[model samples]
Target: MSPDRSQTAYAASAADLAVRALDALRGIGGTAMVAEHVERAEDPKAALAAIRVVGADTFAPYLLADAVFHPQDAAAVTQSFALFPPPVSTPDPPPAGAAEPWLVAWRDWAMAALLARLAEAEPDGVRAPRPTGAPVLTDPDHSQVSDAPAGQGSDSHAAHGDGLPTPDSGAPDDSGPRDTDWQRWSVRMGQLSPLALPGLDGPVHSAARAAPLALARGATRAVLRRDFPTAARITRWLALLGAEGVALPLDPVPLLAHLRLHGGGPRLALDVAIARRLLGLETV
Candidate 1:
């Protein structure tokens, strides 16, 4: 029978044999190449061998996908040197302790290919990192929030009484002030800037002030303990605050403890968030 039209009986038989050959091709690469050689060979047995090899080589990934929702192949294919996205290595770090290496050459051709694949993988855009799982305080008891009123009075009320009280009243009222009478004003707890609190001064001081409250309201209350995402959100917030020269309670001990409890990647990620925050980057 001719290879093209082995006609009636042989066509059906060959197709079945071909399928079996393909199935067996799942395990080895060189074997599949050899199998293709066999399939096209004058001998029918040769063709079957090639297809078998190819079939065997292909089953592992199929079986794996069936077992777990792993994106390993997709990640691998996308991360190929020639097909990765530009953003994948943005601000790529310098090799540890070595002189800075210029990436212009490495980025020349491969970058375009990589970006193409990345675009296909993420049609819209690369997703920003986000905390996975429940919001730490989504349905928080909020008893604390309710208790921690912004001002001594109500949100709308002035300290002593009436509408907007003089801003001076928001300051501390010293017994007998000399210069700067404004210093004599009695500032309400939440009315005045937390920074201006009596002893709240330097970076460490501000950190100390907020640290206790955050710890009390956060750690002790299982805020950072139960919710990693919330902890990350707080880390990002504090980082940005630091950039603005605003002090934050971000000692490594508490930060690491939060991360360890909540479970997230890289301690340095927190540092990046803080840097971004300080630089006026949007945390939202």
Candidate 2:
């Protein structure tokens, strides 16, 4: 099969898998097992390709809920990386206003590493630093979100109430140009949405903490443009902020419902389902 075909098969499988995971997340039906959806094939190459596509999110269910992390699942996620290999190491790009792709890949790996650690399977050979599962912005009991106050500032910096950069704003020195263009900024947040889960934090989460309204605005814009995938990704950030008690520019509840209704495919559905979990909207 062509790469596209593999992706098509994987996306359908992933989405269905996400639906099962979502059910598990809501305490309904059976637990979502990674091996079932991720390994529904005899073709090792295809399975590996699918794992690479979803990256760390392949273990999202385990992270989101108390789902068991069987050894096979851990080995499958680990083996896929060995088969496909990680990206070539790249130097830290100069502190810039926008996120570079390398940074996003590293963040993705951080999520995977966190899950690997939870599974107690120190995946050998992978190079991303270990992720501390410390709570960044999650309160397991958190379940409410509010709208931005009337006349609140909407610029990128002020989008975060109080207009202060969080502690882990960026590189150690915290020096370098910061991107203020909401368009680019929102897109980068969307790409790094995989980091929007509970129990993880860093530059990306810090960056997100600095821009709730911008993230909400970007998500609304994507919805208007019929770019559901982009909208859904940004929604993940919005959902996270809402959970963190940040006053958002929009309500995440209806937005999640909209995506569930119109966001094409299981992959995008997976994003929305994850967003729903972030928002604590535990229902069908």
Candidate 3:
């Protein structure tokens, strides 16, 4: 297939898998009694590619709503990590909010860590394989960083004093938006929205903690510009903050409703659904 055709095909497959994952997220949130499984166990390569697109979100139902973790899904995720790995080398002492390369590796590490914890249940005698770049699990339910040092464990990005980077840490100014610039800041935040999930922590979360109002303002700006995707992603950050009990300047409930009305894709739907759960408004 030509590059264009290949890209198109991959996009279609990823979209379908994302919707299936969305269904599982909604179902586990009580929209349905049981969520649908998302792995294409028949075709490991296709499944792995789809999983790469979905990223850590493949486990949203299991992570967010306590849904059962099937071994097949875990195995697929493991395979993706090993086959389609994150960058092998990170910037030494990676800049906080480092660009795509580090973020990819960092997210993979967190996803792997979460996968390991979910495996502890071992339902039906199926234990998930540990991915190569995962962080060490220490109190999976809480504490974003493990006991390992900041630079330890696959550049999972605990580069500050503790596992969590301080809000005051140096910014990735050249690569990302500076906090003073809400417009560009929002775009960068949107890109890092995937990191906004519960049980995942790092520099981005610390930044959000310090600037809930900034995120809110950024979300509002995105909405004003009719950039629903960016708006929705920023809303996800706000929702995470709300979940963490950080006082948000703007109420996320109404913003979520707005995004639900305007957003037009399964990935956006998935973000909204997870945001609802975070805000204790899980009605699917």
Candidate 4:
């Protein structure tokens, strides 16, 4: 397969594997059943299917697949698909507080376990720190950046301990186009035609299409290479819109609701917030 086609195919395959694995776990029924499944499987697929039959079919397998193919959200490592909260027994309260304790605990445990496994699997420490989304990126808005003259924030960024530029800093470029990766990336960004994602129109669609090129450039230039915050943001959005083959939402509420339905975390939450803020949806 051509590179892009191959990527698309691989994504479809991974998703298929994830769904099948979850199905298997559902078949198993409960914690004990999942453990038994794990004991029997040699490969991840078998392991996932085994886990699927269990009642708490962890989203770990699908989340892992997402990370392998997309690798944008560090949170994905711990994201679980296994346990769906049982229906609320009592009538609805006037106001809800937080997610149920068991659900939250399950998510945390899954995330933490995945993080530990990732650390064990990759000893080189070459990857960027997976984001916990505690402290936000705190960069000025992308629109603000784009609105500024080409050279704005091109320099004067705070240096990291290792001296790599921070997220807000445009990719390291010299005094001219040769000085930075962004310039080259910008050119590629300009060259890319907007993809016809579902429901996308006007500015939002335009921004979504252009955003990936900027992210792609960042990935290629070793700017937060393994850190997939931006890419994940884009992918999750694409998945939702593409799934229905509908236009992307003009408003953020639909998007936020969609994320909640799909399962959400710090990264997806942050993306929803950012996208809302950027599009002026928060003001509405």
* Tens-digit lDDT track of model 1 for 183-244: 11111121212222121123322332333334223322224234443334334334434544
- Candidate 4 runs further than 4 Å off: 1-19, 22-33, 43-135, 139-284
Q: Which candidate, 3 or 4, has the higher TM-score?
A: 3
Tens digits of per-residue lDDT for model 2 on 1-284?
88888778766554555565555555555432556655566555665566666655656667666577677766676776677665565423313212233444555466466655766666776555532221122111332222111111222332333212323342232223342234444654576666777767666666577668667877887788677877888888888888898888789889889888884876677788788777776563
Clash number for every model? 32, 2, 0, 34
lDDT of 3 by residue, 130-235 (tens): 2222212122233332221122211112222222233333254443433323444445556556667777776556667766766788788778868787778789
Better of 2 and 4 by TM-score: 2
TM-score of each: 0.20, 0.71, 0.72, 0.23
What are the per-residue Cα lDDT tens digits for candidate 4 across 1-284? 47776555444433443344344322323333233333443443434332322211133332222223123222222222332222333222111222122222322333334434544452222222211111111122333222100111112221111122224454544334323433332222221111212222333233434344343343233223332333334433333334434353333355444444444333334333333333333221
Point to the candidate with the largest TM-score. Answer: 3
> Lowest summed-lDDT stretch of 10 residues in model 3?
147-156
Clashing pairs in 2: 15-266, 97-179
Candidate 1, residue 276: lDDT: 39
Each model's Cα RMSD: 24.5, 9.8, 8.8, 17.6
